[model samples]
Target: MTPIRRYATAPGVPAAVGPYVQATSAGGFVFTTGQIPAAPGQEIGTFADEVRATLTHLAAVLAEAGSGLDRIVKLNAFLGSPEQLDVYNQVYETFFTDHRPARTTVCVGLWGVALEIDCIAVTGPGGDA
Candidate 1:
């Protein structure tokens, strides 16, 4: 059997800057595109704010897909600089608190921003779930 796929679109979530949807769901899971703090080509502030904004985007995407940050099963993160990790984690903790998702963080070359993030979450409570 095939699981029908649904693309995600949420009001508060900014328009995706390129050829991609914010997220998609299938087989009881929502998978999001990597999200940045601001639209591509836009300048961002401190590493902490970047992390916060990106995660906030991720959460909004999830909420629109019938899930929430608490339901995240796994998260993948990219940091433009190794030094950004400490600040990133500090901001990240505020959003996650005790509900920790399985996660991976990597230092990578980014397109003018300090951070990017995405996640896979169980479809819980609403929308296409």
Candidate 2:
């Protein structure tokens, strides 16, 4: 027997600019693409704002796939610099108030963007997982 694999699409989330799906699920787990911090045509804001937007997109993708922020088991994030970690945590706390997933944040050479984030989560009852 073979397990099922599914591709997920998030409504209200602008189509991925690249050739990649927003999310995919298999074996009771959901994996998301790295969410860009800016919304469609929306200019990038402050470091905190960028983190908030990225997380919002991540949550939306998880919700669309029958998961959510609290369900996240692992989160991977990228930043333009290490100096913004404190500000990022302040904004991140607002989204992940109760459940905190294992996370990794790395400083990267990003162009015109402060952050990008992706996550893995457990599917809810609505999902096969």
Candidate 3:
């Protein structure tokens, strides 16, 4: 038998702009979609603000999925420009703190947003390590 896949919907987080859920879970892992800076019917903000908002959205999704930032095992980040890497890191540290999940970041064009982030985390009680 295969494990059932579950989708997550977080009311506090912005709804998905595309045809995808906020997060999905299966086999003890929760996978989240890349969250952009703009919320529903909102304007994008500064680079730092965008990064902060993206992470905040991710946190909300994780919480809704029975996971937290501390349970994140990996993260993939995209930035509008390489120059914003420093600012991104500064704001990212504030949320992640000492919990350093494996991460990969890249410079890429993001429609009208400055930053986007997606992550994978353990599903239950800090995960089954």
User: Best candidate, lDDT-wise?
Assistant: 3
Candidate 2: stretches off by over 4 Å: 1-8, 39-41, 126-129
What lDDT does the true structure give each of the candidates?
0.82, 0.81, 0.83
**Deviation from native of the Cα of residue 48 in model 3, angstroms:** 1.1
TM-scores of the candidates in the order shown: 0.89, 0.86, 0.89
lDDT of 1 by residue, 8-122 (tens): 5676666877777888888888899988887777766777777878888888888888888989989999998888878888898899887888999999998777788989998
TM-score of 2: 0.86
Residue 32 local lDDT, model 1 = 91
Separate clash counts for every candidate: 0, 0, 0
lDDT of the structure predicted as candidate 2: 0.81
In candidate 3, which residue ranges exceed 4 Å CA deviation? 127-129
**Candidates' RMSD to native:** 3.2, 3.2, 2.1
Model 1 CA lDDT for position 84: 82
Sort order, lDDT high to low? 3, 1, 2
